[model samples]
Structure formats: C-alpha cells, structure tokens
Target: MNAPITIDTPRTRISALATDHTALLLDYRLRNRDHLAPSEPARGAEYYTEQAVASRIAQVEAEAEAGSALHLAALDRASGQLVALCSFTNIVRGPFQACHLGFSVDHAHEGSGLMAEVAGAGINYVFDQLRLHRIMAAHMPRNERSAGLLARLGFEREGYARSYLRINGQWEDMVLLSLVDDRPGA
Candidate 1:
C-alpha cells in the first residue's frame, strides 16, 4: 500500500515510506539527526543505520498492508531531498476509529510551513481515505512551535500528561491535543 500511495503537492512530493527507498530515508535521517534529536525519543546508534531504517520501513509497510498505520516521507521536489516525515500510528478501527500523529521536518525547512503542508495532507488522507474519526497528537510543553502547529491544524487542547513520553533520554511532560473529523457522515 505504501508503494502505491503518492501525493504530489506544489512544492513537495509526498509518498509512503517504502523499504526499497532506504537511501533517501537514510540520507534524510542523517542530515537531520541533530536537528530532530530534541523532540524525538532517544535512540541507540543503530537507529541511524541504513539497515535499521530499512527494517523500520519494512515494518511500516506491513502495518500499512494490515490497515494499522502509515508513514509518509515528504521530499522537496526541486532539490530532490527529503524534507519531512509524518506517521499515523496506533490506528484502531471498528468502534474506536482513531490514530496518533507524529511528525518531524528538516531544520532548514522550519517556519517555512513544510510540516503543515505535509501534515495537513496526511490528516486529510487519514480522515477521508482511512475514515478515521480522530487523530491524537502530543508535544513537549516547552515546544511552542509544535503547539502552534497542532492548533493551526484544528487540534484542540485536550489535557496535559506528566512524563508522557521519553524524549532525548529523559521523561518529559506533554500537552495533549486531538482533531476530530466533524464533517457530515464522518
């Protein structure tokens, strides 16, 4: 499914993460490692390796096929480099139609609205194509950028959680937010 789903935007090309595309993913991760380390969970050295990325991509592909999750890579078409990534994970169907959203963009692309461009399209795909009712996203309380981005995406503040996640090795508090598909028949 990841290999087949692709969305082309005016400034970027968004495609599902595929195992065969390890080179692009590896390049992106390597380039953004320092830039993304703050908000991301602490990872071992192996996490940055091509073999690790390929293995992760393979897992995502399997999850996509099973209708549980999707990981998308956003590329700057003009520069031909990956600029961002977003994932819809922990997808639950049946009566509980929902998933969690997580994303990161190149440091250079920050404040350029690339994350919004990619994540907005991803949210639409999740709501319309996947028919999920809700998307939950959380960010460190100190990260105003993420808070603003989630607000702009129509994700209302839900609550706060203490030590909600481990980021940069230590436990961190999170400001929870959620966006619900409220369109008619959703």
Candidate 2:
C-alpha cells in the first residue's frame, strides 16, 4: 500500500472540485443556503444550480489547463467529505505574480479552522510552490469572521473599496487584504 500522505493542515485535503464533486457541493450549498448567503458577498441561488456548477467546473478546468488559475474543494481527509471551496482567480503572472483568493465554507463547519487551513495551504502554494509574490482576498466589512480569518493568516489590510460588488442585490463595500512574499531570499 502507498504510505499515507501528510500535510500541514491536519487531515484536510483540497482537490479540484470538478463535475464529479457537483452533487456534494450542491448538497452542501442547499443545506446551508441561508448561512452561505452572507459570506457570498455576491452571487445567489442560481450560482448553485447544477448547470452553473458544471459550467464553473469547466471554467476552472480550462483556466487551470491554460495556466491561468486554480480552484479547489476542501474535504475531510479521513471521511473524504466536502467542507469548503476556495479559489485563486484573476491571476496575473510575470511582474504581477498575484491572484485573488475567494472561498466559502459550509455553514455547519464554520469556525472549525478548516477554511483557514485551506487558505494557509493556498497561500503557501502560491508563494512557495508556484513562486507567486502576492495573494489578495476581499470581504464585505460586515463579514467579521472572514476578516478575522484573513488577518490570522498574515494578510495585511490594504483598503476598503466602496460599492465593490453587488451582493444579493445592493452594492457592498469590501475590505481588501493581501499577503506579499517579499523576502530577500525569495
């Protein structure tokens, strides 16, 4: 048998959430629809539909294959259960070497550190593994939990953008946070 793999985020596994994982993702989204509504900041029920989910999977796959972006679904290593979804989108290579982080956790699993674990792993991958210099995440000001998580992960608050995104309907302000890998050795 192959030896068990180990990762920093304790029994947390993140993998491409393709069409194969659509049912799991849809179930979680449906069950926690209300709780997820707040963190979404943008998007709605239509975003969780099977067609949309399949389309997103295709988009992410194409982007990954083209070396443009990376998206992952976080799962419990032991049970192989879906817990959250995260992505690095709007990636700019070369001089920019940066991407934006977006994520959402099942309402039942919030505050369990799973999302944080995923974010930390993504930051490490972007900075060390992919040789990217910076990563950014933005959250609605009222989303205290997300802001806290970003801060705990060493992201510095950059600024707030007015009417950054239309959430549910109204335009919402977003607090931008970033982690820049500017070490001399890097």
Candidate 3:
C-alpha cells in the first residue's frame, strides 16, 4: 500500500483516498445521492454498493501510483465523517503539466466553507507536492456557488463549452476556468 498523504486544517483534514476509506465513501454517497444527483452524472444502482466503491478505491489508488490522478477525501475533524471529495484527474506531464480538478461537498456541509478549506489544501498538494503547472475546473453556468468558489480560489475563467458533459442523463454546458502555479520555478 502507498503511504497516505494527509493535510490538516482547523476544521477538517484532507487525506489521499485509500481502500480503508471504502465504507465512509459509500455511506457519504448513499446519503447524498439526491443532493448530488443534479450536479453529477447518473449512476447505476450498483454504483452505490460497498463492493463498487471498494473497486473504485482500488482503481484510484493504482492511478495515483501511476501518476495519472489523485483523489482526496475531506473528513470532519471532530467527527471524522467524510464530508467532501476532491480530485486532480487526467494529469499530463512533460510540456503540459496540468490536470482537471473536480470536487463536491456533502449537502449538510454546503455553504459552510468546508469545500474551500479542503480544495485549498488539495490544490496545494497538486501544485507543491505533485508539482503540476495548472489545474482546470468547470461548472455549469447555473451553478453560481461553484463559480464563486472557483473565482475565490484564483481560477480564471477561460471559455465556455456547449454540451461539455452528460450529467443526469442530459448534455450540460460548462464554464472552463484554470489556475496556473505562479510561484518561482513553476
């Protein structure tokens, strides 16, 4: 097993997703199914099962080892409950050191700045530890909250895409945004 990467904050801790996290992830997904459905692609009934989550955890772990992706889970400090998920996917090296960023917070934790804390920590890992050059994120134009969050995190709007992805069974448009590492040597 790979060593877990953990980042600590005042209210939460962000850690690399591991197989041991299967149960917590499964519970979080099942509990937030309806709350997250609109923002996510439709999933089959099997997707929520513990077995499926375990399989996904294994796949992500392998991807992390292969340097193609990283998945982080944010847990409440006090309760140790899984409260958010963040990922840097499709990482590209060589001349293009970048990846797509994706994240979501549990419904009960929304509007509480938990995601901001978690995402900040995760982005730091991507740029500092992983040494990625850029992180791109996209959200539906209607998702004002996500737009605001990305702006606050220093991601600049790049463009708009029509029918960018299939979400909840229909094609959805997305506003593209990206943040480049501006530190020296980045």
lDDT of 2 by residue, 1-186 (tens): 012212346857776656687777777777778887755546655977988877877887888777677777777777777788788888888888889999888777789887888878877777776688889989999888998999999999999999998786778899999999988877
Candidate 3 local lDDT, 87-149, one digit each (tens): 999999999999999999999988988888899999988898889999999999999989989
RMSD in order of candidates = 1.2, 3.8, 1.2
Q: Which parts of model 1 are misplaced by more than 4 Å?
A: 1-3
Best by lDDT: 3
What would the TM-scores of all predictions be?
Answer: 0.96, 0.88, 0.97
Error of 2 at 86 (Å): 1.3
Candidate 2 TM-score versus the reference: 0.88
Residue 131 deviation, candidate 1, in Å?
0.5
After TM-score superposition, the amount by which residue 135's alpha carbon in candidate 1 deviates from its true location, in angstroms, is: 0.4
Collision pairs in model 2:
none
